[model samples]
Target: MCKAWDRNMYKLRFIISFQVQLIINFKLIAICSHQIFL
Candidate 1:
């Protein structure tokens, strides 16, 4: 049971980190597009 719980926690951490990276990438793209428009 403990091992299963640890695995779930690890998976959750990975998903959270992945989402953060995606958000940062999106922000960068938006800034670049805005600069081009300006």
Candidate 2:
């Protein structure tokens, strides 16, 4: 049972980090496009 909980926690952390990375990527792209338009 402890092992299963640990696995779940790891998966959750991975997913959270992935989402954060995606958001940062999108922000960078937006900034680049805005600069290009200006």
Candidate 3:
């Protein structure tokens, strides 16, 4: 039971980090596009 809980925690952390990375990438693209427009 402890092992299963630990595995779930790890999976949650992985998903959160992946989402943060995706948001960062999207912001970078937006900034680049804004610069191009200017």
Higher-ranked by TM-score: 2 or 3: 2
Residue lDDT tens for model 2, 10-29: 99999999999999999999
Off by over 4 Å in 1: none
State the lDDT of candidate 1 residue by residue for 2-36, as single tens digits.
Answer: 99999999999999999999999999999999999
TM-score, candidate 3, is 0.94
Q: Give the least accurate 10-residue stretch of model 1, judged by summed lDDT.
A: 1-10
Segments of candidate 3 deviating more than 4 angstroms: none
lDDT digits (tens) for residues 1-38 of candidate 3: 99999999999999999999999999999999999999
All candidates' lDDT scores? 1.00, 1.00, 1.00
Off by over 4 Å in 2: none
Whole-model lDDT, candidate 1?
Answer: 1.00
Q: Predict model 2's lDDT versus the native.
A: 1.00
TM-scores of the models, in the order given: 0.93, 0.96, 0.94
